[model samples]
Target: MIPKKLASSLLIVALALPGCGLVLENRIERREAAAEAAYPSEGRFVEVAGRRVHYVQEGRGPDLVLIHGASGSTRDFTAGFMERLTDRYRVTAFDRPGLGYSDNVSEAYEGPFNTRSASPAEQAAMLHRAAGMIGIENPIVMGHSYGGAVAMAWGLRHDPAALVIVSGATQPWPGDLGLLYNVTGSSLGGAALVPLLTAFAPEAQVERTIASIFEPQEPPPGYEAHIGAALSLRRASFRTNARQVTGLRPHVTAMSRDYPALRLPVEIVHGTADTIVPIDVHSRPLARQIPGARLTELPGIGHMPHHVSAGAVVAAIDRAARQAGLR
Candidate 1:
């Protein structure tokens, strides 16, 4: 016969599991509403490969394209770069697939969590088609962080006018991404924990993550609200982002081999103090690989150089424009 205490404990666990699921469901609905209210899509969309790619186009001059980082959207540009660059260039910023307002590629996972469309090359292909649909051709491509990898793929496949990489994950880094990425990115973890995070992760935790990303410099006032931190926590975004980050290294390895052959004028900007994508490991070696590539090292700056040093990024863009004779 089963002991009364053991049976009672088992019954409680069974009841609590379903109860937690119910709470999570309600939380997701509430959070989704809050997220939409916080950052309504201010951009237009173009369809490519059955996915709606969200993009914001502004300014009027030589065409320029901006691709944002991991867990980021076109709003990252709107946070600062879009306004500053719009005055001189026809700037278009795109939300990477499975992020922001962009439609995710539909696929059933063989395991718990993974993706076939989370690669930089695939994202580049999608955005390239969208660019053509929107009447942009041979524009300068600027990518920050993970977007830098996509920009590289764009240059390889579609021949951009120039390439600007800011704190880009250009080369393979040593070791794994440690516990946070592994745990969140795992199949079991993603399935079980992502919804919980999306439902209940505090705004303060989001603020802390943002602050950490821009370490050595604080987020400007209203940045947390403007950047739509809640959007990143959405279950779909969380899974897609995790898969993308987890699968990045292999893609970058193959992409790096082709860098030496790239003749397009490349501009690489990185901060010396950036721990995210170490300067020595990524940008420095990348600058050397690309023939005639220019490297600008900003002392004391961190990963979010696009926000921290917009002038420098703009200046680099100008140089690329001149080199490509877009001016």
Candidate 2:
């Protein structure tokens, strides 16, 4: 026996919910359209296991595969850093699955409430298949931040000439990934809050996040515009990134045990001041794990060593090529 007033209130709330959902969906669609228009795909696509993988290929020398971090695209490399190496080595930059213009690994993984994400190994396998389609084989693979996990997976599952990890999150760290990832990655948050973020996240906030990622150093001129930060704000990209980052520790823990088995030339570049992926926790232990792995520590630099200290990164890559007997 429901009271008349209570029943009326419940009915009104139920009626309003659909309209609210409609508005949010409309806004999300508009924002996604604007983001794509401003920063369209900068490279061609190849089909890998029935999914589209976007990549940019340039220069001519040894095959070099570049994997950008979480929420990043090939644009991160194409911005300027890839150009620096073009004269010496052929470079191919890829947008990891579920980010940039690359399609999600599967439709099941795209659902807002779905907790499953493409693992680093899965991403590596897909991209490896795509690389094969484009004739890239036994090449030097480099990964930054989250992409480092994928690069390591590539090395373990397949053969690569060399590996360069920049500010990589290689080992499992203490504690969880904090509120943003934990919340956004959850089933409830992904379905309810993600659309709000996608629809209303401001440009200034994106700039601030970019600055934080490059903390202890400023982002280079036009870096924000070139990196296509807007792409990361789309509902799907945001949800997928949160899911991947939140669920990464367990995968890394499993992967870390296999690090000692890697027998290829490995170069690790990390900033001593990096708080995002602490050097002491990730790079230091990683340097000790791999056989004959070389580590280059940049004092006072932050997570983005490739952007802040491109010369050092290039030097490490050169050293890797030489060590691998490719030079």
Candidate 3:
């Protein structure tokens, strides 16, 4: 017989697992079905250095370059920011090399495999070329998560109107990471983990993940359908991103020193309660690093404020633009 306390605790733990997956996989979910809904944002690929890069264009105004994080595509930008700001600005989102519709720079990557380019610096260069190919000049470039590194790298080269980092992994901050995260996010961490989970992870698990990510948001209608779509995103991004752990984290460490060199007006938004990409790694340190940067922290909010607090995200972007004289 199950002891009452033991049974109660076990039940609570069982209920908590799904929620954990969703919260951890925000970038994954953002790229899946939710992206497909933003149709006619359309797939437009261009040749850059003999590589095929996928991109989406929307609206008209000063150009806005939105870059997605690791294991993500332009979809994150299209859904999270572009669709919302289209009326006032022209937004362009792209699939970074090795992810989504974008082709790999080298069919054979060296040493490590990853959803992102070898270095954040390289990813930013590719993005710069992509924008130039599409006629977006000196646009406001915004990056989230790994994309934040790319955005900062790009800003360093070109004089942009402004730069925005959202829940961005600005620099490595210390924290407790569960074994599962290390296995999923670390380079050479493990190979069998993905295959094992993909083969055995259940639909119920995916659904619970969705609920957990949204947490207090109350899963809206047709949410379950969205969760299933996320599963089909092809585990390549996940696998590569898993190995990208060491490659990208080191980049973050080096980038911290270079932050002060960026003269363009900058803004960073972080959630107080963010579990991933801790607030200290980015918002606070970055604000201090950049001579005149502004940091905004959302109380009780987690990493993806775009979902938990849409209005605040919008306001932050607009505020950053205004501060930089973008209007």
Task: Write the number of the candidate with greater lDDT, choosing between 1 and 2.
Answer: 2
lDDT for each of the candidates? 0.84, 0.88, 0.65
Q: Candidate 3: what lDDT?
A: 0.65
Candidate 3 segments whose C-alpha is farther than 4 A from its true place:
1-41, 110-117, 175-178, 184-192, 196-200, 214-233
lDDT for model 1 comes to 0.84
Q: Could you tell me which residue pairs clash in candidate 1?
A: none
The sequence of per-residue lDDT tens digits that candidate 1 reaches over residues 151-175 is 9999988999999999999899899
Report the lDDT tens digits of candidate 3 across residue range 1-327: 112343344334434565556553564345544534543235699888888888988898878888877656665554445668888878888877666666655555422223333577777777788789889976887887778877887877667789988888878767544455454444432233443343334556556655655444545455344223242234454455444444576787887887888887787887887766778666788898899888888888776676567677677778777877778
For model 2, what is the alpha-carbon lDDT of residue 153? 96
Top TM-score prediction, candidate number: 2
Q: For model 3, which pairs clash?
A: 19-212
Misplaced by over 4 Å in model 1 are 1-19, 106-112, 115-117
Candidate number that wins on lDDT, 2 or 3: 2
Model 2 residue 154 lDDT score: 95
- Using TM-score, rank the candidates from best to worst: 2, 1, 3
Reference-based TM-score, model 3? 0.77
